[model samples]
Target: MSETTSKYKAPALERGLDILELLSEQDEAISKKDMVAKLGRSVNELYRMLAILEARGYITTEPESGKYRLTLKMFELSNKFPPMQRLLNAAGTEMAKLSEKTQQSCHLSVLHDAEMVVIAVQDSPYKMGFCIRLSARIDVHGSGSGFAMLAFQPEDQRRAILEASETPEPVIESVLSQMDKVRQKGYFIGASPQISGVTNISYPIFNSNRQVEAVLTMPFLTLNSDSLHHQVVSFEESRLAVADAADNLIHAIGGCTPE
Candidate 1:
């Protein structure tokens, strides 16, 4: 007689929901190892779900830090819920206006669990625009929105989120060193680490709970010009416009932005 070995099985749906729930409780983001310990699931089981979530824009991984977090697409879906429709409707108008005014792609994204998913994007009036995929997700470490979300979190919680990532320890350490400045600046501006030539600036959106629930970002290309003086002036102007629009968006959304 031949002996047989048993294989382990995981409940796919249950595991996905469990991962979301565990992440929800965290103020910062959580790492895969921490998830394994906290959720008591195997690494293979966790990686499968994480891959799905990351692909679906439900979660994002920070490239520099290799951490994962929830995204704002969650709020967009939740807006379909009867209780949230009114606020969502109101925010949509403001999002559109901001996009028009800035002449750069504008995104209204919210955090679901620990990820920031794009709920809305407004195309710029300029022929050259940053056209992002609808519901696209970017990691909390690479974009302005991620910085905004990370900045608002409590120190201990933020540290946990940073430490929880699968990123090599050295990379995490280097990124954490700059986090303090990000927190103090209230927003961030830089080129897209994921995509070449795209520059972006973003600010946090807060809910009644005073927690960062979402982010509004303006992504555009820095036009290459032979006239260095003109290029410098244009960049400065665009940055100011984006900043003003972000503040206006915060006021327009009020407490319903998310928490």
Candidate 2:
């Protein structure tokens, strides 16, 4: 907690938020007993907070297990926020077009603190395609989309993110070198370090002030030769399509590339 946050205290609100945060990190529903243990709070104190959250539809109870889990309410609320809404509106059509043109899934990500978060994604039109889930958090120094966004940031901001990274020093140095190349090439195209047989193509989307606003990424997957759709999009084609989609989204959002 920051000094400013500590200065102004709201015990009830903090408890509620803590519960929400805990639930968000959990992959399975948690019982009230588990929540109490995890939060280190007494059952008496959490009962009301849980009831309020459940009543407000921010959380729901699993009928059979009688455990609590988060609902989609928070995600829905985030999409209604103005800036995110604008970004989504601008990128939605272009992302769809990119997928249709490249026959590969595409996603839009923005930097949030030291990490990148997928805010929007468009699945490929084909039955077999690579798709990243919305709201997935990605390592800032470990992805093509991360490099694309970081390559264009103001030097001080980039340095700050690098300083906060937990990656090994040697890996961070390599990523820095890769970011320089991304700046020179105006995009990134490489095999994914996390997955086999997948190529990542990414472009930085800039705002009107020529600041990177987001990264548009296509995880290109080569389809099997025996598949019904034998037409394979070449690497060059996917790169061009992704670049064009990034350009279109920037235009739609009234953004401009650095001169």
Candidate 3:
């Protein structure tokens, strides 16, 4: 059949994007009827669009409820692009400067496998702070970096991550108890449980999709002798710096960017 005469010649491209955009805006899953009503498309057309989106891994539907929501494809697509590299490149020099300024170790982390994984780090010249390893997996309930990232996650996803953390049950309960404290303070501050005399300062990084995609962590300890015992650095300054840098990076990579 001629392209213009074919019933299957619907605007597949537009419909697919529409589905993604619509799902992203919704805080909860939406029904097919609601989707068709909002998209102003016929039932058949919406069904076809939803099918294509699901097959492409861009959207998901409840097996029993038939409700739809956005999938992790958004994160996968963001990672597939080179823009994250650009963020690192743009901020690498600045990160060094920050470490030098504060005389403290600095690190960057991104959410992966529902855990906060360190992707970059700049150690302090003083050697007093914990040295973070690249690709280290941190518990969402324990580390300062993990708490910073988890604080910004969607409620359901956050709960799931915490539930699945490998941390001991008692520690998990204590961390959960302090979540409100973390949120109210806009930071997680405490002595390092894994390392003595180490302080952790961390903040989340937002992506173009406005999802908390990563975190920047700083570890430092006072160089002064008997500086009031173990003192972890506060996150106030580092959070602002990471937030600004992340905003710039997101704007740069709003769409895919070349190396």
Candidate 4:
């Protein structure tokens, strides 16, 4: 079956939520193998979700027993995520509009340490399009999402954000060289360094505090010559549209463009 129509998608997400709900009722560590059995799924099926949970600190592993257990960190983060939730709620429709207008998929990403975490995505209405996985972590130095976010932050914060990254020296220098150009243009258009035949166009979303909180991106694809959607909009069209959409969302969430 095609990935978009696969029955695995819904249940896989259900399984991730199920793990947290099950663990919240337990007081002790549970083995991975046992969780597998309790989950009624193969280890391979649960591996990715479990790793994401562990990395995000919703669960912790015991070194002695190598078992997993719930942590209060998720609760702590839940308290701080209301604003983020608000942004997603406000931006959803606008993002869908962007996809409809540009015939390209777009995603919203924010800095998490040195990585960019995709928090929201809207797929193009076209039969075929790019879509980034929500909660996916992207390398900050080599990605357009990273460049948009990095270029907009104030100088001090920019340095700190860059310092946290462990990108190769050549890549770091390249990104540094591109910062001013990106800021001057007020958007970034770069080759998807990791994905072939895709262009990642990114713009920053600012808040009333004048802080660039998130990057909004459109991964415009190079369509097959025989593709259904011909005469797709140019990169500049997608760029300008996303910039306006980002600004609208910023205002929707009580933010303003930085001066």
Candidate 5:
């Protein structure tokens, strides 16, 4: 409540923040000498700030080269806020429930920089199943979640994503027909041509604008298909489970279904 405390500032904290901001703008690490040149500060001035940041696990220094770059701590912290945090909380719960019931590995994906990035993954309840790593990027045309998202998006936006990739993402008649089917059926169920014995089932999660906000996918697999313990889940069963999960997720986050 004191007037002086409200206006008080820490110059050291400000300098450390400046370094973090600068490092974030770079695609690669920055050397101490280069950092000084870019920051227009003496080495001594920034040395302590760098030391503290590194010690606190905010920035990391390369062993081979004395260059420094930011760590994932900031990104992890940021995911605790808006849209993404809200999404994770809701999707995690739904994905867990889906996986438990279906005994199938599932993941939540979002379109990032023209690619589908897996944000969260839930393992199958079975002893043997596959789980995708967090932050893995998948091809827009080749992945179930990727294709599912693109199928629901506006045509122009989809076109832009395809055009932006240097390697031409193949557009085939079958894929086109499948997209039409996905839109019509409200879900996608198909075998992944790239991965044998793995079926990809995807559902679109909507936002307040009734636009496709994310894709919820189950990379279905049979562990010991011949084993009498596991019962085969039908395509219709998978579709309904994923669809219900998406709907429950929408309610959790106060979102809408696509129009």
Candidate 6:
């Protein structure tokens, strides 16, 4: 928490938020006992908050297991925010077009607290394709989208993001070198660190102030010889297509790319 935020405390609200955050991080619904142990709060203390959250439709309890899990309410609420809504509207058409053209899956990601959160995704119009789930959190040092956005940030802002990263110093140094290459090329094309045989191509989307607002990434997959949907465009063509889609989104939002 920041100093400014700490000055005003709302204990009840904090407990509610803490519960939500903890649930969001879990892969499966968690029991109240586990929640109490993880949050360091008594079951009595969290009981009312959990009930309120469940009542408000932010979370739900499984009837069989009696465990708590998040609902789609938060994601739906976030989509209603005007700025995020606008970004989605601008990217939707272009992202679809890019996926259709390249026959590959693509996603748009924005920086959030030193991580990249996937906001929108478009699956390829092919029988076999890859798609990342919405709201997926990606490591800043491990994704091409992260490098594309970080490489274009102003020196001070870039330094701040790097300073906030938990990556080891040696790995950070190596990532910095890659970012330099991304800056020189004005985009990123690299093998994915998390998945094998998939190349990542990413371009930075800028706002009116010439600051990077998001990154558009295409996870290019090579088709097997027996696959029905063979690659239509060359690798360079798909990369350029992703760049064009990013540019189109910027134009749609009345934004600009830096010279």
Measured with C-alpha atoms, the lDDT of residue 180 in candidate 4 is 88
After superposition, candidate 3 runs with Cα above 4 Å error: 1-80, 127-129, 225-259
**lDDT tens string, model 2, 36-102?**
9988899999999999999999999999999999999998898898766788998888888888887
Task: Give lDDT per model, in order.
Answer: 0.69, 0.86, 0.69, 0.83, 0.81, 0.87
Off by over 4 Å in 2: 1-9, 62-66, 224-229
| Model 6 accuracy (lDDT, Cα) | 0.87
- Please provide TM-scores, in order, for all candidate models, with all chains considered together: 0.61, 0.88, 0.56, 0.70, 0.73, 0.86
Largest TM-score belongs to which candidate?
2
- Arranged by lDDT, best first: 6, 2, 4, 5, 3, 1
* Each candidate's clash count: 12, 0, 1, 4, 0, 0
Candidate 5 minimal-lDDT segment of 10 residues: 1-10
- Winner by lDDT: 6
Candidate 1 matches the true fold with a TM-score of: 0.61
**Candidate 6, superposed: residue stretches over 4 Å from native:** 1-9, 27-30, 62-67, 224-231
Model 1 error, position 208 (Å)? 2.3
Predict model 1's lDDT versus the native: 0.69
Per-residue lDDT of 51-167 in model 5, one digit per residue for the tens?
999999999999999899999999889797787788898887889899888878899999987789888999988777878888788887788887788788766766777666443
The per-prediction CA RMSD against the true structure, in angstroms, equals 12.2, 2.7, 15.1, 11.5, 8.6, 3.0
Which residue segments of model 1 deviate by more than 4 Å?
1-77, 81-87, 163-165, 224-233, 255-259
Worst 10 residues of 3 by lDDT: 250-259
After best superposition, candidate 3 residue 107: deviation in angstroms?
A: 0.6
